[model samples]
Target: MLPSKTSVTDRSWRAGTAPGALPLLGHVPALWRRPLEFLASLPAHGDLVEVRLGPARAYLAAHPELVRHVLLNPRLFDKGGVFDKARQLLGNSLSVSRGEEHRFQRRLIQPAFHPTRIAAYTTAVAADTRTVTDAWRAGETRDIGDAMHSLLMRVAARTLFSTGLDEATVEEARQCLRTVSHGIYKRTVAPLGIMEKLPTPANRAYDHANARLRQIVADMIAVRRRSDEDHGDLLSTLLRAEHPETGQKLDDGQLLDQVVTFLVAGSETTASTLAFVFHLMGRLPEVEKRVHAEVDAALGGRTPVHEDLPALPYIRNVITETLRLYPPSWMAMRVAAEDVELGGRKVPAGTMILYSPYALHHNPDLFPDPEIFDADRWAGERAAQVPRGALLPFGAGSHKCIGDVLALTETALIVATVAARWRLRPEPGSALRPEPKATLEPGPLPMVLERR
Candidate 1:
């Protein structure tokens, strides 16, 4: 028998259960079939709906206000669930750290992403973007997804560490990162303890990739230590950072975690977002024209600089609209630290809570004609009217993405630099679909590079 829907005033703290749950698997089959659609439909069931993934029961927050409440009260709902799975690969990095440790790590890493510091990186961002786009011929066919991933990886290595990796190493790192990301996703959803320990092909591959990632980080750390010189980059900042109160520095293991966190976190999301933006442009020619015009007018054929960012409002809007439609970090999970009342319902301690930017961005009530791509919605007063917590592509509160400034800067600069010179034309019959891995990525965006 399926669980019944409960009323808000029941006061029993019993959440309305989703329909079509099987005997033991619960809603796992439905979620596995269409994860995004299944999550989006939960609000119709109740404000706070019960979801059973295997034997574990979790609450899905469907209302924007409830999501806001949960995000704001991080102490009551600390990072857990999927993040705990993420820690197996990420170690105790900022993304997985809790309480005082997370705060201290944030402080140590905060200076690297400051506006002034991010501004200094803009020159390198533009130069790196140009190097890739300049190589594209007028009639060349390319996989834009691969191009964006490669471009962002190079930019990250250069801007974050002031190091240039050979093409082979970059390719190897990309593959290894993808493996680790896929492994984390698999473990989060399936969570078979015994399966992870067995020498299955997937398990063996994950272990190998993880070891390679660690070795790469160790090598980078060694080189930084040997140089012992400040390159005025993020690596230099992290190496020199000290806690204000304790005056203690991060040990090698902690430093490795932070470095790997920045590289993996920064590269994947930015690349996925850029790839989506290019795909959207290919589908919507009118939007592409506006973006190209804005870039041309603002930049005048020169590479983008810090000053050009503000002048290119249309380009920024295109990026914003793209994020609204396809947020890279689509969903986040937190565990209740204590039994807490939410939406007039008591959620017991040890319960997991999930909030999806993907669902929130697609809510028809919050955004009119939610499925359409409209950059105009973000222009002028329309942008301000978007409710708080309604548009969280970068997330909210203390755990919000630390790389927002850098990510936005890189996107705008890349868009302007490329749009000024070439138009990406999606090849006919190209199968573009959202493959939800660690990030919401568009798979293999094949397109022709048409010179403007």
Candidate 2:
């Protein structure tokens, strides 16, 4: 029976009593099958629902208020547990650390992604986009996912590592990234500490990919150290950076970790976003017309400049709306550090908490006709009705994406530049579907780019 408010004890309140799990594998099958559907179904049962893993219970909170509390109160919670496993691939970079250590690392790494600095990289982004698009013959078939990936790969190569590793090396890193991303989810769901011991096919790929990633990042770091000349890439910045208070630079290991963090975090998310943008434009004609009009008016037959970014509201909305529907980091997880009370319920320590941005964005109460692609929602009085944290595609509070501005600027410029020059339509009979991994992307989005 469901207990009344005062009758429930703290432990029961926190636990919230969940449905029984399937035998040994527990909810792993459901989680693997359709994670977003699994998350969306939780709210119908209760505000908080627990699902048993092999042994431990993973708690999910559905309400926005609870999400705000968890995000804002970093003291009460931290990005450890789940992130620790990720740091195996990312190192001790900003994505995993906490408190003063996290603060210092973010400080040293922040300058490279700053607005002025990101603007400085626009020329490279434009050049890369032009280079890739120029080869397209009129009415030729293309896989947009592959195209976007190539463009993002070039951007990361130019803007991320200071050593400027050649294209072949960066391609190797991209391969490793795909393997590691798949590995992280598989390893995390496997029984703790058993991932490395297992001889499964997935585990074998994980091991090989992780080694390749580490070796490439390590080689780039060594080259950076030996160089006397300065290049303004993120790797160079980290190599030369000194902690403001301690006046100490990162050692070789730490530097490699940071590089790994940048590659894994920066590359896929940007590529996924551009793929979504193209998919949306294909479906929404009015949005495409307005966006193209805005770009034409702003550029006036000239190439996009960094200064024009602020004046492009419709472009910003298109990017924001894409993120809302298809957030890069779809699910965020945290383990309870201590017995705590949330939303008038007492949750015990060691419970894994899950937040689903995909579910929240689709909440009909917050966003009417939530599934529709509408950019005007953000333009005028319509945006005011939405709650503060409700529109988070880059997330909210302290753990929000550090590279959001860079992502948006790259999206606007790349999309506008390409859209102005070509008309993209889905290949006949191809249905755009969401292939959810670390981010939402249209799998092998085959489209024809016709010369405008």
Name the candidate that leads on lDDT: 1
| Pairs of colliding residues, candidate 2 | 14-346
* Cα lDDT of model 2 by residue, 1-452, tens digit: 23333332232323353454688877777777887777656655555777776667677766665676677666666675767777665667888887777888877777767777777655577667787788889988888887888778777777776346787877777787878876776665445776567798877887898898888878777777797666766676667787777887889998878777767777788888898888788878898888889888888756676787776889888988888888777788776678887656666887677878887787776788888888888888988878656666777666778988888888888887887788888888888777777777668889888877
For model 1, residues 102-213, the per-residue Cα lDDT tens digits are 9998887787788898887666888888888888889989998889988988788777667646767767877888787777777766656667889999899999998898
Off by over 4 Å in 2: 1-29, 44-46, 49-56, 192-205
Best by TM-score: 1
State the displacement of the C-alpha of residue 184, model 2, in Å, after optimal TM-score superposition. 2.8
Q: Candidate 1: which pairs clash?
A: none
For candidate 2, give the lDDT of residue 408.
85
Among all windows of ten consecutive residues in candidate 2, which has the lowest summed lDDT?
Answer: 5-14
User: CA shift at 448, candidate 1, in angstroms?
Assistant: 1.4
TM-score of each prediction: 0.93, 0.89
Looking at candidate 1, what is the lDDT of residue 251? 78
